[model samples]
Target: MPQPSQDDLKEISRDYNRLWQFPNCIGAIDGKHCEIICPAHSGSTYYTYKNYFSVILQGAADANKIFIAIEVGGRGKQSDGGTFHYSVLNKLMESGRFNIPPPDMIPGTTCSLPYVFIGDEAYPMKTNLMRPFPERSLNDERRYFNERLSRARKCKCN
Candidate 1:
């Protein structure tokens, strides 16, 4: 997939805000294990903890549940975080080539937050990536925050 431009990221954030009530969110990211036949001479390389041979398929989708980016061919034994860590998308993001916009104020608010992609705990937390609060001790505000974030992260494609 082609990389989205800065304007495209902004538009995706707007869509998340309008459709999912999640502000400053550019996309939702996740990974899936696609079962595959084991290759010759490959022992456990493709064997996953889920007891299957597969490859990881990582994807990021807009609020409309449209996939804008994908990374495939990761070893099935890897966790979502591991797969993402080695992905081209992560490299672009870390190298400042992803074209994400600078931090800006949310509408009707004075707080300046960086535009971010929402994901589950399997993904690392970064300035441009958001994960739910830990499930440990929870206050009302944190609980609500997790609820909203969970809703925004559910960008599964049909």
Candidate 2:
């Protein structure tokens, strides 16, 4: 693995703390392109999107909306929604090290409580994976979560 630069590490640190700032919160996630020079052998692997040829990097961040960690170099064809199924990120969530926030499906916990992670429509909405309310209301909990997200960041909440 390549080492993160001092500047990169600093930025990551800022975002990581930000995401964790809220109770039961994890980082927000999405993928975008970073242009790469084409390598002849793996020609088609470099696909184009929004007029750029690059690989998509998926990531998660904390409530403060800071970038805590990222999964990079996945083929562009991959969906951000599917990234969580199997990855280092998923493993961390499954393990106890990353405390799950409130509203965890698990009943009865005796301690300070783990933080919860928020997800979006692209992700499978579930008790463990929280998707913000739909643009049009689907249910009370969805509506509540959506409203909460919107209030957090002007155009973006989750």
Candidate 3:
């Protein structure tokens, strides 16, 4: 087995960060579970959405929805927000570990564009991350946000 060098990690992060564009330019965040034999120490904490005692796997994807980095082995009961907090996502922001590019150069944009993650209901809302508003009908705010992302869209493989 071999380990990637620091440069390799930086390049990977940079690519994922630039994946698409603002609102559209976020990495995808999702969680899965890995089955494991019940551990005497934390069996109860390992129960998850699937009713299994397993370790959770968290991942970040590019605009293409291709996985860029992954973290696994946390207890399953952990919420997506909790999992992200303990994973590289946290360290990246705190230590400036991710290789995000400088702000976009498009004309007439006052907002400082941000690279973020697209999360689900299990995650928390914040500036660096976004989630679909859990409403029966998409209202004006959600509509505007969603419209911006889709308008700036990239292909699934892009």
Q: What TM-score does candidate 2 reach?
A: 0.58
lDDT of every predicted structure (CA atoms):
0.90, 0.53, 0.63
Q: Which ten residues in a row have the lowest lDDT in candidate 2?
A: 100-109
RMSD of each: 2.0, 7.1, 4.9
Off by over 4 Å in 1: 155-158
Clashing pairs in 1: none
Give residue 2's lDDT in candidate 3 (0 to 100): 28
lDDT of 2 by residue, 1-158 (tens): 33334344344434433543233344455666667777668766666655556777777654445556788876654556655665566665667434443332212334443334456666665444556666766687767657665443222444
- Of the two candidates 1 and 3, the one with more favorable lDDT, higher being better, is 1
Tens-digit lDDT track of model 3 for 1-158: 12233444344435544544443244667888889888887758888878888888887665555666788877888887898878776677557556544444333455665555566666777656666666577889887766544433333442
Give the candidate number with the greatest lDDT.
1
Ranking by lDDT: 1, 3, 2
